[model samples]
Target: MPLTGRNFLYLLIASGIYFLSARFAVLLFSLEPGNIALIWLPSGIGLLMVLRFGYWAVPFIVVASYLANSAGMAAVLSELAWLHTSTAALSNGLESALAATLMRRLLPEGLQSFQDIFPFVFGVCLVSTAVNSTILVVNLVMAGFFAVESSWMIWLILIVTNSLGILLLIPLAQAVLQAWESRLQMRLGDAARCIALFIICTGMTWLAFDMFAGFIFLIMPALMFLAVQGRKESVYVTLTVTVGLTVALAAENYGPFQLQTDEWSRLYLLSYLYSLIVLVLGTELYQRDLLSEVQARQSWQYRAHHDALTSLGNRSLFIPLLENEMKRAERMNRAFALALIDLDNFKSFNDSFGHALGDKVLKEFAQLVRKNLRDIDVAARMGGDEFAILFPETPMSEARHAVERLRKQVEKLTIKYHGRTIQFTISSGLAEFIPHEKHTSDAILGRVDQLLYEAKRQGRNQVQA
Candidate 1:
């Protein structure tokens, strides 16, 4: 909220944008009775500024609202114009600040899930807009701008128009802001596809509003497709464009909502637009939540089963796989092999070169194992410096040859860490699972451990079967 150089710059930009949007809305969508725009986009702009810059934006909103309103009303009201314009500006600023404050308190996470929609619509949008509308209408009646009897209708119109402005514009602006801050990069094809979908949706929206009302329903599917397939920013932009076009066309009496009265038509149009936004955008948010949940669950499962250092299966995953493979070999009347491998003098190596190099050696060794093994083979890191492998449907001779090849590769593997050339070798024990042997995983593993110890005794960097 402090008026630093950056804050001052942002305030200037926000005020400029708010004033321009206000002028544009009044020029295009203003109704006769009170000169109120059917879609008051400056309300949204004010709210966004307040949300982003906190209470520092309130005075700028007031100044921008005063400038925009006073320009239009100065000729008619003359001296009393200052009072009316000042009241309107104060009301607009208050609405934005209050709405932003409520949103920060009630929806701290900011419209992330389906549960957020109701609170945002009712608590922030309706509540704040209603306050602004009430204050503005009361001020107008006091200033002889409208009859006391018509204050209720004018107030309702203001609420609907301002609420719709916030509802439509906030999401679009937020999406664009997020994309900008993240520097989101899209492939050329994907960007093209998104632009194409947006254009198609925009065209369809024009047809729906300008030509036939029945086409309105058809536009939703295109928007839905855009929501599902395109980026979040694109989807919000498409929705905003369609809604803007609908309002513009309706203001000119071109849409299907050209009913008995402009007020009724506006109400009908607002209803349709509100439902359209909620259904499409709500669905998109729900889908995003579901995807995030699924990804988090998958990441949790992967971390649970895999070694964080080597990305190989851990004991938890490897033991079950080994047991399953043993059962499969027995059921199919086939033979398989298991190997237990350990790095020679790993503790002393770690003491000499530190765990950083030790970790590099382990990762390199895991990669080597994966490279030498077949698709059907299973490899895992069984805690520090020890690894296990299951060679399914393989004979003892073939398994020994595979282990020997792996041992030789580990010997040749060199890790350059901190300009130090570090080389490590592995000692492994290979055991075979024959059909009808009825051997358990623990029994096989125990025999393999003994062979591993034997290999270590004979001399390191050897495979003892």
Candidate 2:
């Protein structure tokens, strides 16, 4: 979400779409038909646009509001209606602008995920909606257009409508946009099946809403089906069908909510709010659990491939890495070197100092290898006192110098063990991998092992190349 001239254009277009949709919804669901919408969407659109673009988009709110109000008024009243409604529309523009500004001031950092939606819903939504509603009521009544006795009722209606719009519309829009960005191409069959399912569900919902309101319960299977599928498009489509049907049915007073005409608005409002919350939270948590499972699996895989004591790559990981490096080197026709390191007098030292100190020596030696080698090099614990290092793109001469420096670093190391300072030395064997003179990983490994044995035989604390 960055700001550009093109982004400003998109925001303006989006504001128009949101304004038109809100006007349409209002016409359908207005308690006093043809005058005002029970739910006004401009507030939500304003906040959302500000979040997506930047503060510059706030002026679009004024234009959308002015046009929406002017058009709505022109359809019923004379041109003079614009004179009165313009002031009201100004409040709306200010309402939306205030909502967006408050949201920014309140959530400067913004939400990290849907999981962090509560505080935002509470603090910013409530306060901003209150500001917008109050400004609107005061603005209209002061202009002598709005009546005084019904002011409280209008205030309450505005609050509920604005809050519902913010809560339901923002996340729904987000899910749809996310699906679009995922670049998932639908196959012919997939598209057909999804559309067919949507039509069937819509038909069922229509029947339930028009005739047997209890049949609305039948949509639950489809609802759960879409939710469990866990695709953003699926979720957004399901919400569209469900919300569309509910609004249409409730508007006609032909649904389950018709049983109590006076309570339909409040009850349906709460129901929509609750339904969207459940759908959004369920989708987010389900995806989070899947991600957690993947991360946990990766953690176990890492532990499986690493030496537990030294926290270095063990035989399992090291061998494959070496093989892969060899293949890559061969492909590029580059040279690399491998060094096998064995701790000198390690067996006798462990016998004298106990296995605990022996584990310490192994860990310390791994750290020394890391500190000595270039970032391009790979180091691993072959096991116990044995280790290996791969120096990518290094010649035999460079490898020898690097290994000698590591040997010197190891020789200078000191460890405190139970009131005593202890020290150890390592003997290393080096071999350079030549691309033209190719060999299997096992052949290279076997040659390095032989050189390490020769180094040990010649007397410990020496490096053989």
Candidate 3:
């Protein structure tokens, strides 16, 4: 890539971070003959850079790996350090590029489900890391760094460490990236829960490594709780801290695995940590998918039953609601009221002011209905300029009074559109259903329709019962 301003800045930052993480890993956990750490953090860093910036990041990875490896070997190998470090750098860069490409191909949707975990682990982690480790170990053997017979063991160690690096870091990195992209905000309770999980994991890590081996198992439950109840990013953060602490203490011979050889201990820990990562991430992703599905279903249902223009319950919803209220009134041996309302001269108003203003007027009237009605009352936009209201267990006198009040409110309702003032009014028909009276919902609706036309006939802007 050309050294444009943004590209140069990204390369500089990526190379610096990769170099620092490599040096840190070498200083803390370098193995014999190759300076290979049991947990090679730079591998993960390089892969993250490749995934973020594409293949443009490979040159920076190669440069950083060369510097880190040559710094460790220059004094001893002197002349040959250049050759060995060059090969190792190429391998590191190649590993990152290959892993990123494979991940994109295998998980086109990113890691958001249980099925994604398998492809990520097998395709990106094991396959790419194995190839890179083989290349590096072969170069070491050719340079006389280790015996030919020992190449297999060295390659095995490199695979385990490199795989562990990618497995541990990538999921956490993805979570951080997703959170950043979404501009996620945490509520007070959620923030508190995340902090509590972090504290619990930290304390548990100390006890497990420094005091009791059995305490390590308890950390899994803590992580599981965070995965299920806390945010995805928070869960990954707790996992990273817990794993980092466990590895650091174990390397210092402070943990239960100290009894085993260093290589075997690292391997065992890697296995446990890999399983932990999968289980926690899998649960979080599954829960997220289920939540998305539920939200989508609810949105569909709401759109299906509600009016698009006014957001009131449409005919599909109102008829069933009316029937249910009638059934309840009969069961309670009570009377209930229904009101059918029509806007006066709405067609002429629509022609005069345009459909846009007519829509605004309808929406405003729906809001008014919502504001004036009780919670138990039901309002629906039956069709254009026609609305229905259900007042359960209310007598005709009470219903008529409510309708009259609404009529007065409609007379005072004025809508201003584009500096043009528009005034409107409503005519309503009220019908009451008394218990022991044989009536179907359609019969009552027909009666209300006749009364509504009768009100319109007498004059507009009046209520007829």
Give the least accurate 10-residue stretch of model 1, judged by summed lDDT: 27-36
- lDDT for position 104 in model 1: 92
In the range 1-465, model 2's lDDT, one tens digit per residue, is 567779977987987876786677767756543244555666677778777776667677767777767766666554467666676666666666666676677666544344446655776667777777887787666655568886776777777777766766665677677667977776777666666666666777788766776666666666566555445566556665565566666666646655354544545644654565455545554665677789999999999998888788899888898999898889999999999999999998789998998888888888888778788888998877889999998999999999999899888999998999999899999999999786999999999999999999999888999
Clashing pairs in 3: none
Task: Tell me the lDDT of candidate 3.
Answer: 0.84
Candidate 1 TM-score, true structure as reference: 0.91
- Candidate 1 ranges with C-alpha deviation above 4 Å: 187-193, 327-334, 350-357, 414-422
Q: Per-residue CA lDDT of candidate 3, range 443-465, in tens?
A: 99999999999999999899999
lDDT of 1 by residue, 267-298 (tens): 78778888888887787787778878999999
Least lDDT summed over 10 consecutive residues: which range in candidate 2? 31-40
Model 3 Cα displacement at 303 (Å)? 2.6
Per-prediction TM-score, please?
0.91, 0.59, 0.91
TM-score of 2: 0.59
When 1 and 3 are scored with lDDT, the better candidate is 1
